[model samples]
Structures are given as C-alpha cells and as structure tokens.
Target: MTRNTLEQEYDIVVIGGGTAGPMAAIKAKERNRDLRVLLVDKANVKRSGAISMGMDGLNNA
Candidate 1:
C-alpha cells in the first residue's frame, strides 16, 4: 500500500458530506460567493448516509 499526499487550499472544508454537511457547504457558499468550499466524504454525496440510494427522504422545505 502507498500513501498519497494532497496539497490544496480552501476557504471552507466540510468533513462529512452526509445529512447536513453538504447543506452547510451550500450555505457557506451562498453567504460568500467568492469562497472555495470543499465537501469531503468516503461515500458519494448524491445518496449518502440516512437517505441511502436516493435523495427521497430529504426535507424539501
């Protein structure tokens, strides 16, 4: 096994990408249009965590 290193910079880095992680990233972007926000997670954000498979249970409000 090998280790890879990443060198980068971001104004905001959200660690989870689950339930509210993505939302927080969005909100941060909305508040500051110039910010560079990065949302990271082991799984795909499209259908990760409690939602599973799809974004069906997401609160629309």
Candidate 2:
C-alpha cells in the first residue's frame, strides 16, 4: 500500500498489476534478492482478479 516514487529504479516493473504482475515480481525478486520490483495498475488490483470476487471464483468464471 506504499506509494512508489517515479525516481526509483526497479529491476523489473510490471505495468498491469494483474495476476501475472505479482507472480512475475515475486519470481524476479526471488531470483535476485537485490532486484527491485514495481507493480503498477490503473485499478485496484485486489479487486480485479476472480479470487477477489469471492463468488463462483475466477477459474469457474
């Protein structure tokens, strides 16, 4: 929930902040501990995926 500054330089920057964005950032960080990852999205990613909907679930949808 921290606001990232534009001046920061991340080893990997994920623009969509969707399911893939988090996955990619985690893997990248794991592979390189020194790597800095930035995830950005236009909307609240917490509510964007199927898991967040809490209904039929994302896979079923």
Candidate 3:
C-alpha cells in the first residue's frame, strides 16, 4: 500500500460529522464565503450518523 500526506490550512476546522457538525460548517461558509472551512469526521459523513442510521430506519420502518 502507498501512503500519502496532505497539508492544508483552514480558518475554521469543525470536527465530527454528526448532526451539528455539518450545520456549523455550512453556517460558517454562509457567513463568510472567503473563509476556509474544513469538516472532518471519523467515518463517511453521508452514511455515518445517528440521523442517517437510526432515525432514518426508524422513520421509514
């Protein structure tokens, strides 16, 4: 396997892909389009969260 390194600079770094994390990142960008915002999550943001996994299934079921 090959390893890669990434270097980035951001004015705002929001951790966690859970519920509020994405919202916060969106709001920050809305407020300042020029600002650098980074959103980091342990798992895939789209499929990893209580709302996506639990609530979605519960509602559909």
Candidate 4:
C-alpha cells in the first residue's frame, strides 16, 4: 500500500465529501476569503454520497 502525508497549514479541515461537506467548505470560504480550507474524502465529491445520483432529492435526506 502507498502512504501519503499532508503537511500544509490549513485554517479548517472538513472531513467527508458528502452532501453537507461541500456546503460547509463554501460557507467557510465565504466567511473568510483568506482562510485555507481542505476537503478530504475517500471518493470523488461530485459522484459520491447521496448526491452521487444528483441533487434532485436532497430535501429528503
């Protein structure tokens, strides 16, 4: 297996690229444009979580 290490400084680190992860990241940036944000996930944010299919049924979740 391969190993990876992240040594950069970040103001915020959001785990889970799921339904709410993206929103949180966006809001953080909006609050402070100079903030360093990182979104980590095991899968692609676009095609992962409940949104994998689309944002059509987001209210249901």
Against the true structure, whose TM-score is highest?
3
For model 2, how does the per-residue alpha-carbon lDDT over 1-61 read when each residue is reduced to its tens digit? 9997667677778766555656677678789989877767666544564344453232121
lDDT of 2: 0.61
- List where candidate 3 sits over 4 angstroms from the true fold: 1-4, 53-61
Tens digit of per-residue lDDT, candidate 4, span 1-55: 9989877999999886667876788789899999998877666545666564566
Q: What is the lDDT of residue 37 in candidate 3?
A: 89
State residue 59's C-alpha deviation in candidate 1, in Å. 12
Q: Please give, for residues 1-61, the per-residue lDDT of candidate 3 as tens digits.
A: 9999899899999886666776788889899999998877677644775564655442222
Alpha carbon lDDT of residue 5, candidate 1?
Answer: 97
Error of 2 at 11 (Å): 1.4
Query: Where does model 2 exceed 4 Å of error?
Result: 1-6, 49-61
RMSD of candidates 1 onward, in order: 4.1, 7.1, 5.7, 5.2
lDDT leaderboard ranking = 4, 3, 1, 2
lDDT per residue (tens digit) for residues 1-61 in model 1:
9999999999999887567876788788789999988877777545565544466344121
What shift in Å separates residue 60 of candidate 1 from its native position after superposition? 15
Clashes, model 3 = 0
lDDT (CA) per prediction = 0.69, 0.61, 0.71, 0.71
Query: How does candidate 4 score on lDDT?
Result: 0.71
lDDT of 2 at 12: 77
Model 2 lowest lDDT segment of ten = 52-61
lDDT of 1: 0.69
